[model samples]
Target: MTNLIRKLWVPVMTLMAITGMGQMPIFKRYYVADIPGLAWLGEPFTVHWVHYAGAAVLMFMVAVITIRWFADREPLTTSGTLRITLLALLICTGYIRVVKNLPDIHFSPTFTMLIDWTHLLFAMLLGVAALWSARTGRRSYTKQTESLRRI
Candidate 1:
């Protein structure tokens, strides 16, 4: 389980964010439209499947990491902690938006827009952070390999 998580976390998060980001433009366009510009995407359940499914897996992974992090008794690294925090926040905002901004849900225009933009902003930041984290991990991996070769 630990090994699987270590290998798959970044890829999973990256893929989820990509799909979520891809869905955003359509979401925004049709969020308040009369004819519903994004009907081509799919029915509600189909469109939401990507978001909800990714979120479920992500939450499960986060729970696993949180348990392991506490169990290991290791010092928390700042970057790792920050990344986790951001990911959690992103998931939370995404959930709230899902509940609040649906076509059937009638929220104030300002409030709906706020949730939409908030979700987008968090998603963007999380994406950038994930990319940076992956790059940093690869650099360390390369450095270790080079040192091992020298040895």
Candidate 2:
């Protein structure tokens, strides 16, 4: 059970995060319009529901990884640390941008540029980290299988 969970943990978390990353507008349009019994769901309610749920799941995953990173009790690679940092930054910047108007904060051109650029940069870095992790995982899996076959 432990081995299975260990093997499946990251992939499952990644899937959940990716699912949560989907745009809410598209979800609202298709799900409420095409699906039955969903028409009664107000646009704001549905949008917030899906968005918040996904954000919660992603945040949970982030917390788990962050705790693992800080506790020094788990084996986390440099790539993993970078990935977590980038993900955190990405999520935070996104949240700020989304809520920027809610606070009635005056949006200057410079501030807007900084937020947009930071978000894009972190997103790109996260993509690189994800690719690196995937490649490393595949290599490790291949080595393990090869060793098992030898036995």
Best model per TM-score: 1
How many pairs of residues in model 2 come into backbone collision? 0
Lowest summed lDDT over 10 consecutive residues: which window, candidate 1?
Answer: 138-147
lDDT of each: 0.67, 0.60
Query: Candidate 1, residues 52-96: lDDT per residue as tens digits?
Result: 777788788879877876675555456666666777788787888
Q: Which pairs clash (backbone N, Cα, C closer than 3 Å) in model 2?
A: none
Cα RMSD of predicted structure 1: 6.8
Which residue ranges in model 1 land beyond 4 Å of their true spot?
Answer: 25-45, 101-105, 137-151
